[model samples]
Target chain A: MKFDDKIPIYYQIKNYIYRQIIVGELAPGDKLPAVRQLAVNLTVNVNTVQRALGELISEKIIEPQRGKGNFVTEDQGTIEKLKKLLITQQLQELYENLHQLNVTDTEIVSYLQDYIAKRKQVQ
Target chain B: MTNTIEIKNLNYRKNYRSILEDVNLTIESGKTVGLLGENGAGKTTLMRLIAGVAKGASGKITVANQDGVPEKKSVISFSEQLNGFSSNMRIDKIIRFYEDVYPDFSTKKYNEMAGFLQIDEGLRLSALSRGMKEKLVIGLTLSRDTKVYLLDEPFGGIDSMTRKKIIQSIIKWKSDDAVILVSDHYVSEIASILDEVVIIKDRTIYTQKSAEEIRSKYAEGIEQYYESIYEGNDIDD
Candidate 1:
């Protein structure tokens, strides 16, 4: 995957995996690829991949099976929480950007609603 | 034992001219480090010192915990070794030569890399293009089961496709816990794969920073940060 050079690579790696999970590309309880395989696939350092997986393991989003490999957490609640967290982070960025443009919070909401309506009409 | 490279108080002078002075750097296992510097910034000289090919530097250089030149040379694979081979020799013959000289050279790994790199072992070194030669050099370097790998500008003068292939081969073949130090003047080509970057300037190590730290702290790409270092100093001192 192409990466933005301005962001920490491990952070981008974590987000890539999170995106796969949120999109159901990786189902709960599904085994993740071996760390070396992931590193090769991403064209990143194996240590960087390990760092990203380490954070995921700590967050309980992934479970480590001794001598086997890593797997996505089976808890549907945890997956849901992860999805909500991603959405909130993205919305926060959008909100802050609009605020910088001198748009009030109420106007930001209205503008987002209008934008969605226009997009739906085009679809 | 962990594979590591440690250099202390290293200095190199030739014919009363100092090439490098007080160079100190330590690289732990499992890192893919980028050695960044302008041409003649002592990047190649430093790698030569680490690989034990160049002598007369009054400092301690150790690789895989061994300080002796022969011991250090045994565990390190330097790309410059290919220069010693005859251009009339076929690719397969060179591989055999490597096997005979370096007990650590693995024919099996060489074959795998050869196939992955699409190198024709039957072709003489003179028949290969620049990109092909580089691919062969990289294949030969990585085919060794060594603790440290020093790649000096493997991507220089190569096309983008060849560059991408080399990058892929590096990622695919790098053994865990074995450090690879790749030196290149251009940063963006190999930035993503690097764990840390060591910038050499003015005959010494200017700075060494983790790649992620540069990204997160400076909010800039490795190439940008490297370029910023020489912004106003375009004229040589």
Candidate 2:
């Protein structure tokens, strides 16, 4: 779990799991690590893990079966929806920053292409 | 294996002077336990004994064991009362040292904690303030993912802001099956968080019970409970 000093830890965990789902690393219907297991593995408090999981459940990214465990929801559309939600937030911030810098859409797209190329190479 | 801690007939003697007398106690796992005592009440010694740091202590300390014996490094994370880091070591270096020693140490967790704590990655430990250094030590210790955590006077010398951060870290570090033993004199700050309270007097475990149980049994909060015990009043009153 990569935590941000500026952001709440639960939000970070929620975003992390969402990213995993978007990247196809955590597939639909795959069960996540148990709350206790995740807490032990991440060294975060179990309550934090529970909070993260609960948020995911509410977001429809994961579903919990009573007495069983939480599983990734089978709906890819929901995943896409979450991804769009996060992207909108990022875009809003980017728009503000670019506007302050007086960067045009063309220049931003060119810069983004270069960034995407570099990221792909690293991956 | 249920999470439980039990000590029986524990005794420690140095120079024919009893450091800890026969003491028996049991603390169930998955709860926050506060060990309250004034200075020289053997809180550190008892924690050390539970952590297996002392070799000459005579007794059985059991954690989740039917036989009532703590397995080696099995049931404890004893943070020393004194700061134990090398003065010359870098902060990250000490973290790596603990990473190698404790099987459960997580680099990812350390990185995450570092970010949350907003600690400078490149600074040497000696460069940090006393409060920041304590936070760093606590972050490292709490990142061990251990079953039993023993923190000795973690709130000492730190400001209220740092203390709140430390407490939040503890809340995050605790698991459902873990037992956290925090030793401190600031009973008020910790009393709210503790599930159980243990008071040490004359080097022996004088009293132990859940916070609610203690309150119900004695009609007083943890502070008054300690006062009564120290004043030689019956705990059941």
Residue lDDT tens for model 1, B98-213: 99999999999989988988998899999999999999999999999999999999999999889888998998899988899999998898998999999999899988889999
- Candidate 1: pairs in clash: none
Can you give the TM-score per candidate against the true fold?
0.95, 0.63
Instruction: Tell me the docking grade of candidate 2.
Output: incorrect
Candidate with top lDDT is: 1
Clashes of 2: 3
| lDDT tens digits by residue: candidate 2, A19-62 | 88888899999999888667545544565577789988987899
TM (chain A) per model: 0.97, 0.82
Candidate 2 per-residue lDDT, tens place, B1-237, comes to: 364788889999878889999999888778778999988888888888787777587888776564323454744666772267767678777877877777887787777777777777578877888788778767777777777888988888888778767776776556668889999977766664577788898788877776655654555667777777788877443
RMSD versus native structure for model 1: 2.6
- Clashing pairs for predicted structure model 2, backbone only: A45-B172, B61-B70, B62-B69
Interface RMSD of each: 0.9, 11.8
